[model samples]
Target: MPSSIPRSAAVSSVVAAALAAGLLAGAGTASAADVRIHDIQGTTRTSPLVGQQVTGVTGIVTGVRTYGSRGFWIQDPQGDDDSATSEGLFVFTSSVPTVAVGDAVRVNGTVTEYVPGGLNSGNQSLTQLSRPTITVQSSGNPVPAPVTIDEESVPDAYAPEGAPAAGGSINGLTLDPETYALDYYESLEGTNVRIGTSRVVGATDPYSELWVTVKPWENRSERGGALYGSYTAQNTGRLQIQSLTPIAQQPFPTANVGDVLADGAEGPLDFNQFGGYTLTARKLGTVVDGGLEREVTEPQHKNELAVATYNVENLDPSDPQEKFDALAKAVVENLSAPDIVALEEIQDDNGAKNDGTVGAEQTLKKFTEAIVAAGGPSYAWRSVDPENNKDGGEPGGNIRQVFLFNPQRVDFIDRPGGDATTATGVVEGAYGRAELTHSPGRIDPANTAWENSRKPLAGEFVFRGRTVFVVANHFGSKGGDESLTSHHQPPNRSSEAKRLLQAQAVNAFVKDVLAVQKQADVIVLGDINDFEFSATTEALTDGGALYPAVKSLPVDERYSYVYQGNSQVLDQILTSPGVHHFEYDSVHINAEFADQNSDHDPQVLRFRP
Candidate 1:
């Protein structure tokens, strides 16, 4: 939330005294200015007259600021009649001009486009008037009526074609105020808007921002949040509420999905880099909690073994001791310290130092030490070091998947002769069942799909009388993919191809083990970096050889990660046909909270082996 300057009438009189004090108020009006607010705002994302000087822009003062470089916002009472252009614009006076809301004023300034992020970012810049000289034409002038936004007004689709050639750039296309979500938001950028009694769709973020849906979400859930679907069908009804009220002045409201905003909110619309369009609230209403509670899963029974997957978000020995402690608590208290836990993003011994330090013995040791200190069962880890710099992640961080198991409950089958370069294959071991040639070895290490990515770690673990093969994976991320509001319709999922290939490789390996033993209990789990309803998951579970355990959880509780306003599942556990009738839980210790230790929530599965 950016700081705002106080709009005191006394201050306005002191700055623009010639008009506000008495003279200009008596005159009542100024001659018609050559340029209007719409001319400076234009229809596109970038201002058409950026860097050009404009004179005599007239509008009523809608908002005034006194903090930082104090300034005020002005909006034309009668706009250009073009639905595409915004009527309001911010006037930066550098604490010079004191303007009160409802004072009609004439401003002269340079038209500028301020990019929130740098130029390289695809984000559109904010159009503003800088170094403005203000003259109050009249005081007590009525401001423009705020446009009301309701469910029927928001469109289902989010954006037009996102590619540059397809009018993806904000400046490239003519916005349709009623058709697409992006268009509707762009049309209202920098204008006064009102949201009638809406529901909180997204949990409040640390910045005091929450997403709300006006009314009648397309796939409305009982929780008052819109259910996530294909990206093409953007959840248009959902709008982000950004509080301009400083935390010290008024605290940002805390809310969860299904919470009701009885009075809704009204604010000046703003566009920023993080979320496309946002409302800087002038009046924020009350929040009624949905009473959503964190779910506690049942503990594993005597004969039952619980296996879990957790992404520690690149944990290293150098990380804060508290982070490790918090993670360990989530595993012990929230996840019940499963018999076997597949850990992702475990860096090498040197942490992030780039000197070819591949062994993670020190890293795993510190984590297990913290777990024990946190009252969790003492755990042992098994992992094959990867060729440094070959696995993708941070430049110096060789992030890989590792297995942590409670030795008292499960035995990790370790075979000799495993190395970073060689691929692991299914082979006959002492038990005469299908087994990894090398426990905790990379599966198809040389596969092109695993190139510069985290290779799957296949390790065999035996609990009681059952043997379960676990494949721990961290797939390629959705890095270069377009945002939800991208110009390209159905924003391209650029990372899907590589993940599909990785999924195929893992599926092939699972098939080999199942071929050796039709009922081989193989568990593949980790941060797949995709949804359960994605093609990547389809590739992994093709032929019904492995089924996603997440699908078994209730739909509303299926999410393990929350991005933007969507509570989506990016981490998943897929089990072989041999493993059935298991209880699963997507532990929600993180993701929904503002002070989450990790970006992802861990999941656990319990069943009789």
Candidate 2:
């Protein structure tokens, strides 16, 4: 039976017990003549002296964090010769610390290992001194020099192999700071670190944080961001940066992909819940724009049919009018007003108000009207209302896929009798071609693979007297997957199982259409929520039913999303064998920009059938 409290929770409880044992206000004090900062850190992920009280551990204060887990970090100026043990340690004070930088202080506290997001989260534990008692020995002492992080310092190998007998965990393994990048960072955890002028790989987010790469040449994209091509080649140089100075005192720089952090940053290397290893900077760099610009795809020729996919990041009727207008502008200008646009995450009319309302007429109307207002063609839309709360998204939003088409250029073949739970099938048409039994219908809605997930929407369209079958998908997300920085050597991607099944289901439906008519013009496009090289994509392209069109572009320009500093592919447009040549463009209007309307960059495909 599973324990009532998880192992990490139990560990946390022990730390709490230590804090309550008259140590919070420095009641029990011990001698510091035998112990040092590195001694408490040990040479493993967790402290060897964890849960034990130690006093008179002395160091110079290097950095102080006044808010959000208020604490100050101290470093021994004369560190031990072993590179495996860190010289610096964070002292948790639970409130504003009276200490300042350069103050030599002796601390007494319980050594504890704090796991961020719990052990089940697979994150490495941070060695820290909790419930500390501080004695300022002297003032005006120089803080320890910061270790510089660069290409040479970070190893190409991401992590060391876990101990097999220990259920593939690296927690108990000795630190190899010289061999692996993860171990190298772990050895310097809570230590003063510095990076020279570096290129920004991730755009500054709402939380005043960004990512930069110390290795400028490792898997570098054409736009100055890191490209995540495969699972094995995790870019180990990416380090998240956060300012230690209060935002009120100095505003954090706003940066985009390819921007430069000119003078670089220096501060303590800390680990936290969001990004594993971070440089909480006491001295920050200035932002120099790299001149990266948004891309615009050429409008489709008169004889070509253009189809596009865009995830509007859970658009709703209650969203700000400016957001609606900006998205409309992106659709018209950046996307070049494609003949058919498959939009994902279109919320219901009431937008997150849970009252069993699943209709999106108001939501679609406002969007289509905004497009017209933005100087685009008047568009008609079609979508099946999902069962209330069945689709996985924000609670009460009932987000679903929608197809918007310009009736003047293309026609939506609307077949009656399609509902939320009904599954659509491929059938022989009057002209001996393949057609959907129910136009604007859900595909395999009852499949267990689609449980609590968005079902694919299948629609039949006619462009210039040629019939085309289009399937729009928004597969299960990678929500529960572990981060790349997990202590587990190869981070677990538990979400891919459901996505693989989803892909196989969509692939089976496309194969059915090909079975009826060998020359069926089928196109599958949407936010797949998986990488192009993932097993999910292989399943979707199984037996050659469809070909991912994103592969046709240059390797560096293939991504439609920027995630955690890695430019990657999540949205894709795939075409069947019957559809031969096409032009594909992944418009970069949103993902890489600091100010954006959506989290995804829309993709467009133009072809003559």
Candidate 3:
């Protein structure tokens, strides 16, 4: 049986017996001297005396959580010399205890290794006192002063490279309290600590949890907010804030990046599954928003051609009509019904039926019908279906990229030789510009780099007598990647290398077209699944072959996705040199709201073509 238990449930009989005994300290006090908190919390995540029963554990109650795993944390007034071991411990009472904050209590309980997820879950294990029996020695005792955590307290690096012991995870590594962030947090686990003069780095979640960073980044910090961890500099200061108070009494305030916890959050440090190190805030201060608001792009110019890229998030025929209607509204109302839209994740006719159906004609027709019904112009679309299971996405869905263009605004030039197996190539055409042999064709579909991924769909459109080439892509995802709070300091990004190759393939095709016509209007856009500052983008923009359209916006305004309170850019619209001086808008319709239609926000670029 797994050790993972519901927070509201009771522990095993052994732990229950210990708890019953501890609570029934009855009438007499034990003669045993109070043990220092650090003695029970050794240098590692697990206690040295784990699985053993101990008595006279003394401390002042610092915080009490009444709802789940009804428990309170206690910290010793006089701590030990070893900075590697924490001075605080949680007493799991299973129900609200009679103990009050600032009360000097001596607890008798069994020490155990409580893995938040499970023993095999690779989550950080917390050392806690379970089934505790408490004896309140006195009331009105002063709580120990919280240890202030600032830049000097946390290390620059987050963790060591490999296993602590052979075949073990970095979680079991020996403590380097002053050198690694993981080691430092392990040292202070279950301790009443303080983050003085702190600012919120991430937004507050529905669960009332927020992330903050105490230390400043060595490199020029972006708006004093912590960047996601990297190899060169692991963001060691980032810490999650978990409120212990009930939602009704103390609802967590809504916040954004650069918000201030003016009084500085103070709490007992805890290690949990979702976030590695969290402070169960005993006292939460005021939150000041950094003036971050939902961004709106300027409307399109009548004479200029407007093109947009949107990830429809697996729209298939089998999906509900409301989803299609909502997506059409997003395109018309939010995206302003651009002349041309590059759409990714358009699924097959009978989505996920696993019957080898590959056409998306019904899906396209339904979307167009919805668009017209939503007060938008009727749109025609083009797409090439991939062989079953060859294109990576939702299994059995066969998701692919497609282009939706209004006949009143642009014309999609059609040619021959477009099929699932035949790769599209740049060829000389009648317009004195490079053209695709097939208007809507897969680019290098058979290439190993595109294995199990959506092949880029290249299409040529004539707008105002000028040919504009558009390549719609949906790259391999960042799936199976390690978590940001993983045991590894800067968790490995195994997906980046594959994205680089995809970028290279697309870049080579762009270069081939540009070589023939230096001023070719080429638009490469879709769910790139990478940041603007990443190696994948670098590959796309090498030697100024293409310019990222999002760069036109202010640095603070360049984002299309928000995850874990972080506003970031994963979808982008990059264009060739010919298509310059364009009005670009990263319309913020979805990413920030709970009622989002898609994970990605659509982007539109209006330019003369």
Candidate 4:
């Protein structure tokens, strides 16, 4: 049966009321054959005896969760010799159980499988026992020794192929813990597990969780993060770490990328909605500063033009002044005040208060004023205000791409008459140079490819004696994509197709500019919301219309975003052939730190025309 309320506190009240009212009368009290933890958690992802009453299940309590889905985990110390079946299982008590660690207990309950985010979320089911009746057989019994999770323990292969009859799902496959990494973790699903002093690859978030890697050498980035280079190399050693201890009892560590979790951690392995295969630590580790410093790109020379792209993450006038100030400092200090910056996610004034208001003049004014306050240049801005509530973002915020340029360093060419629906075209200009038909205009905004997504914003600028064409983009997000730990092997990226089409549209627009002037200088930059090696990037750079500048850096250093312990590329700067010989830097200020102005790290590109 599908779980109606996964991890919800209401589950406790409902289950308790049912038991108190005899709604499930004698469900767990019936005389039945003894069932070991391994038998309940069979070789597959689901329980074999689901919907049946299981009695005389005996084990020692390893951990107790007092909060959400209040339950206690029990493990059979005398486990079966089979390596595929887990020795432990979670007994959902609904309310906090009186049992403590090391207490040997006999449990009687109904076997059930709980999918964290519901059945349609594509997550694997977590086999567990519910409406448990517990009897403390003894106290002070030793808990099962935790299995070490090291590089030698986990397999290099991610998972085996799904059965042809199962529609590419590995859920029905038998566990091969020795052969596949996913199966290896599944084999110890609810059991006690431990990792050595591991490197903190993903920074700790507000959720009081962080990620660490047991295998330091697996796809290691130069900055010590696990680099997700492709779909195939998933870096199996990465695991999520959360504490079973209450936050009121002890505050979670504030860790950044490259930090060390000293002394390691031991915990009950769990599968959840956010990050699958999480280790809810009963014995958590402390953080040791890794001395990771944020990098600053060198300032542009007098003869060179520096351009940058940053996703301010829904910046609006309603946000705190400190946020605006922090972003201004990042732009001025960390980015060295690039001559031109293509900003994404600049929300309309009065953020998220879904009214008819779609103008962002106040938002831009506040930001530019903050830039000057941070001892930076007086930056002028240009943008086409998107139609109210049409672009996908905060309900009514109407986020769009904007151009911020230092008036002293570059001149924005304004050809009037551009609006929300106007599509910009390229035309031959003075001295056979290419110019935009409407500066700060949307590209193919009416096209279905941009249907609820942000359309590419194109603009014209002149620096020194050369003209440059810049297209700022914020493509469709990966909202519906499955996690790397999905039950479907090689998780399907359903959001990729829309991004690929968006990339094609931008590519075609750049091709139009290049066609008008063979040596046209075009810079397409922003959060494409796809990886540098993804098909979206390939489509953007198809036929050599543009080159992704982020690829010029070392593979380890190409990422501008980090998600779920994997450092990856989502924002990029792609240049036309005429703009060759440029220097690119994915400034690592925000994404690697727990305290950040934005989730995306800004990228800058400098080249001499």
C-alpha RMSD (angstroms) for model 1: 7.8
Ordered from best to worst lDDT, the candidate numbers read 2, 4, 1, 3
TM-score of each: 0.84, 0.95, 0.76, 0.95
Listed per candidate, the RMSD to the true structure in angstroms reads: 7.8, 4.4, 7.0, 4.3
lDDT of each: 0.78, 0.89, 0.78, 0.88
Q: List model 2 lDDT by residue over 29-75, tens digit each.
A: 33434589988877878776766788889999989988676798999
* lDDT (Cα, tens digit) per residue for candidate 1, span 1-609: 432323344433332442233311122122324688887777666566665567889998876655543566788878878988999888877664577888998888876665443333444556788767889889998778888888777776677664465444544566777677788877887788889878777778766788888756566643455667555545778788876555788888888766777788877777665666777777789998777655566789989989999999989999999999998888888888899999999998778899888889989999999999999999998988888899999878899999999999999888877778888899765656898888878899899999999999999889997899999999999887756754345556778999999999999999999888888899999999999989999999988789999899777667787766677889999999999789988887677655577888898988876
Model 4: per-residue lDDT, tens digit, 1-609? 211123554543443453455322213332346878988887777666666788999999999888666798999999889999999898888777899999999999877666676555677767788888999999998889999999999999988876666667787788999999999999999999999899999998888889999998998888889998998878899999988887899898999989999988998998888888989899988899999988889999999999999999999998999999999999999999999999999999888999878999999999999999999999999999999988999889999999999999999999988999989888887777788889989999998889899989999899997889999999999988887878787677899989989999999999998988887889999999998889999999999999999989988897988888999999999999999789999999988888989999999999987
Question: How does model 2 fare in lDDT?
Answer: 0.89
Alpha-carbon runs more than 4 Å astray in model 1: 1-33, 40-53, 64-72, 80-82, 91-103, 108-143, 160-173, 216-225, 247-251, 258-262, 318-321, 348-358, 429-432
What does the lDDT come to for candidate 3? 0.78
Q: Which model is ahead, 1 or 4, in terms of TM-score?
A: 4
Q: How close is candidate 2 to the true structure, as a TM-score?
A: 0.95
The count of residue-pair clashes in candidate 3 stands at 2
RMSD of 4: 4.3
Tell me which residue pairs clash in candidate 2.
none
Best by lDDT: 2
